[model samples]
Target: MMKFLSFLLLGFAFLLTGCSEDANVIEVEHPEKVTVAFFEALYNEKNIEKAASACSPALARIIRHYRSPQAVARHMFNMSYDKVEIKPDDSGVKVREQFKNKAIITVYFDGYYQENRIKDVKRLSLIQQDNKWFIDKILKDPF
Candidate 1:
């Protein structure tokens, strides 16, 4: 009788523990929207420092090596100097993705420059951290 009673108690304890577990409460965060927004802001002010703050925080190297906040801005500002010649056409970033502890973004701009037009061009990879994005490539061409 004692052996049977102990087995019953063990089963009851197991049941209780299983019932206490909260299995459907996992929370995941997506960082893509935040990154896209950062780029838009960068286009506006051309400030590398402000843009850096928008990245994932792991992009310190990228921000630090940009010559200076102003230099990076100059490039961005020049892209549209004559009338928004270079600008990103669109972005396809998604939500709730574990893409990488970091990420690489390929930027494509479309606009006009001195009667010259640019399209389907400009590629870059950005590393993300703590809500910041940093440039891994300033100018690169695969083709």
Candidate 2:
């Protein structure tokens, strides 16, 4: 009876805690959405901390190292995404790419910095940690 009670209490505790990403900020589930939101927070809202929150620990460190959010925002102001492709795995529609903890999201964009008319593609490395996806790295590819 004591064992059953302990198990029941443990289950209840898990239910109460849930799986919230962060208590202070909005929770974004998908990797693609998180990437878009990160850039939006950085470029549009000019919130470096908020942008950093959407990234992995390493990327967050880089963002925090910047002098000011406004400066980073200014540098990225011209960038805009054309599309995002989330790599699909054998899991199908129900749990696409569920088997893999890490994913690469391809972001196609136009108008980056001084080159307003140029088109470019960037691959964002994302890792699922604590049941939340965070951007870990950004890789630029030649057009």
Q: Name the candidate that leads on lDDT.
A: 2
| TM-score, candidate number 2 | 0.59
Cα lDDT tens digits, model 1, 1-143, are 99999999999999988764522111123333334444444554454555565543455446546655545545532344223333432465542254555554444555444687645444555554454444444445535
Model 1 scores worst on lDDT over the 10 consecutive residues at 22-31
Residue 45 in candidate 1, Cα distance off native in Å: 3.4
Which digits, one per residue and each the tens of the lDDT, describe model 2 over residues 6-103? Answer: 99999988876764324324357787777777766665555677788888887788778875675554343334423322222223343326546777
lDDT for each of the candidates? 0.48, 0.63
Off by over 4 Å in 2: 1-26, 70-99, 111-119
TM-score list, all predictions: 0.42, 0.59
